[model samples]
Target: MGCARWARRAAPARDIYLTYNWKWNVDEEICGICQQGFDQMCPKCVHPIECKPCVGECKHTFHVHCLDQWLLKRNICPMCRVNWVIFRKFE
Candidate 1:
């Protein structure tokens, strides 16, 4: 066949490696309460999903678990010390 020669020279991939890098779209790179990166798993959380980034009305960012625990002690944001109001939780 006309294409046989080229096909025979093609090298087969013995191994494949893949990776990706992603970050939350927030102003803060680290959680105020936990002091951990928004991309990192919260210390109190067992799964990555539970450590999702959360934003407050004051525009501060925190890990979900970190914020949740901080809220239990006081009703104010850990960063700004403002009234803690959940603006949104990013999944």
Candidate 2:
């Protein structure tokens, strides 16, 4: 029973670890507005928000500043135009 419970707990942790640690590549996660890698800043902005926002469905990422600016005019993903505002993951 203890082993089974540990396995259940470990599975999600492993999945999350692999999902982020294994699959995450800085080269691929470029900010659309700035065209910079994850480690870089948005060109139009001076200060950088540590956790960037990603649209969950299409997996497009952006700086919070850029996304918020876009949201002011339109409530959609800049890349896919998929009615964004919700379903976004920041970090």
Candidate 3:
């Protein structure tokens, strides 16, 4: 029936909206890198890329390129010096 088809379509739209809201909320609170609340930045680097959260526990979000370069020099977090290897294991 027409009603059944409309209901099916509406269900998916509602689900998509709910998912978007949840993702938005999570991204706002958690850092993409450290997976923790927003923290400080690396002193050596400047101009982070749009403030995306770090994907680790240090929760110290930073610019992608800045953190990438820093990691090349050291395997530990700049803030807490937590081993990158340990962080990877958790992921």
Model 1, CA-based lDDT:
0.82
Which lDDT values do the candidates have, in the order given?
0.82, 0.63, 0.45
Candidate 1's residue-wise lDDT over 1-91, tens digit each?
6697557665776887797777778898888777888777788877665679989889998888777788889999887898988898896
lDDT at 57, model 1: 87
Candidates in order, TM-scores: namely: 0.78, 0.53, 0.36
Query: Which of candidates 1 and 3 is the stronger one according to lDDT?
Result: 1
For candidate 1, give the lDDT of residue 51.
75
Which sequence of candidate numbers ranks them by TM-score, best first? 1, 2, 3
| Model 1 regions more than 4 Å off | 1-13, 46-49
Cα lDDT of model 3 by residue, 1-91, tens digit: 8887667434443433332211222223434344343333334334232333344465444434455776899887666788753222211
Per-candidate alpha-carbon RMSD to the true structure: 3.0, 12.9, 10.1
Error of 2 at 91 (Å): 5.2
Candidate scoring better on lDDT of 2 and 3:
2
